[model samples]
Target: MDPLHDLTSHDLRVRHAMEYEYRRGTNPSVAAININQAYPKAVSERTCQRWWKRWQEEGVDVEDKERPGFQSKVDNEELRDLIEMNPRFSSEEIGEILGVDSSTIRRHLKAIGKKYVSSVWVPHDLTPQQKAKRVNTCKDLLSLQDSDPFIRWMVTGDEKLIYYVNDSKKSEWRSPGQRPVGRPRPDFRQQKVMLSVWWDKSGIIHWELLEVGATISAEVYCQQLTRLREKLKENRKSLVNHWGVNFHQDNAPSHTAKMTQNLLKDFGWKIIPHPPYSPDIAPSDYYLFRSMQHFLDGKKFKNREEVEVAVKEFFGLKEKNWFAEGIEKLPNKWREVIELDGDYIIN
Candidate 1:
């Protein structure tokens, strides 16, 4: 019997007690004495007498009480499935999928000795370097790991590709049973423009617009450097030499190609490259695209030009600091990301 569920255990014991009492009531004194042989563990005559009187007073529920604690949010089987699915999913993500809170997730995980993973959703457009930069930057920024003393700085940027879907800001997939029938699903594939920018804490941005559906060539890459050169000037004049401003970029062919180096030399720029295969680090990989995607949900455009205009409008509305705030998460997360360096973080 479950010791924690008083009603079930009490009902069982009392039913047995009633049968014993009824048998004793019908038997001769010799048999009655024999029935007295039925006793609780270590119970003598006096203890049995006390127990019998207590049962008489309380009815069949001799040991009835409330259930001991909260019911478990996740059971062993589900926990095992989640651990199998992704050993890295945090308490929060597991809880989200299970419709429980993170504490419950942690409780189950701890009980099973399972580690937690993050549940962050990522868009498909980020490059590997963008991914790493975002994770490491956020980690360092959160942990306040400013090894450079008072004049704190960090660079964050992502190459943005605009599609018709990019205008529809936010869209959610309905549950299987809730999907509409008869009509075909909307088509999302199409040609669109790509734009990229290199930005820093001081609010300067060097941006480029690219023609979509074509491989970016050395000439196009050189054009982007031309834009960067103009943007980096103090009064649209000379370039800063040896003045360290960390340049962040995704691993797009244009960003890493030899063409990029020739231009960087001509107009000096400090570049810090992030590791490949991690998107959780790119600020725009998370921030700009999210904001833009939310804006694009359910909207339709006549053409790619219309889509590009919509994107500019969407980004234009966002105040500059909206992007600036991404840098604030530094310092606190320094140790966590550094310790697990090059790994994806989903916070």
Candidate 2:
């Protein structure tokens, strides 16, 4: 027959020629080279070797065969479009739309660089003005740190809800073929207490566990500040008398209330500017509370007294350097916030 011109005919002709060469004991490399010299598009030596191995093991049939339940070609563009439209679509859902098996869809999705992950939780959806304010505030703080290193004189504090029972699920070592150990589901409405804590570069300055059914009003917050001032006089007298205190706290209703502001002015402490909805930049949120949460995990507390003891123990175990390390991270965090254009520092 005249040498085939169209692609399919040419492909079959080349395969038949390869079979002929194989039967005649021609080497795969030599056959591939010879075929390329005679054909339009070249086939690789690896392809020739693969066909030879298949012929020896499974018996050769050059004609394309339909797989049992798999498709030979998937419209990758359509698949990409579907994923771009709604990334939450599962493999099965994509498969249904693409008329393929879920396994096939999964393989294709991976090939196209798609991944499924849980969304990161942020404190708030920041508007453009909020993001700009975060960036500008961080810049101003960085400039202030450059002029005078006031981090050592800074006193930062925040309040957190401490649960009576903290349940954490952790991984464990197990024998091969053994199922993982299961843990009971956590209760959503477990009893909890409010813990207000203050710290500086040195260590814990003051802390309190509030009574049940009590909240920190502006008056109450001022009382706490007053107590904190006395604690500073006792624990950090030099900071109070000489270097002075740079107070840091969130803009909660109580902390920013008129009475609270007046009290802070009366004490003559400089208040650090904290951007709204920016827990990521707060030392207590990103550092102190993060470590405290880890310590509290898997622990069971009977009452406010037990929780208070645990909180004290947690602070007692931490070294002075550890507290300083957290305080020192402030500058780097400010730079990072600026670098990210006010995005929350997830790390």
Q: Which candidate is the best by lDDT?
A: 2
Per-residue CA lDDT of model 2 for 30-103, tens digit only, reads: 98888778774446677789788878987777754443565756788988777544443456556645657555
Q: Model 2, residue 324: what's the lDDT?
A: 96
Off by over 4 Å in 2: 1-124, 171-190
TM-score of 1: 0.50
TM-scores of all candidate predictions against the true structure: 0.50, 0.62
Local distance difference test, per candidate? 0.50, 0.76
lDDT tens digits, residue span 1-347, model 1 = 11212333343453455446534553323333443455322123343454455556765343323223534457769867765533434454456466665456555655664432222222223445654665666555444445553213455666654544323212332211121233222332244456666655444366656655543566776786676756666522322444454556655556667878677666555665444434444556555565666677666666767866776687678676766665444333344555654344544
Model 1 residue 204 CA deviation (Å) reads: 6.2
lDDT of 1 at 308: 63
lDDT of model 2 at position 175: 19
Top TM-score prediction, candidate number: 2
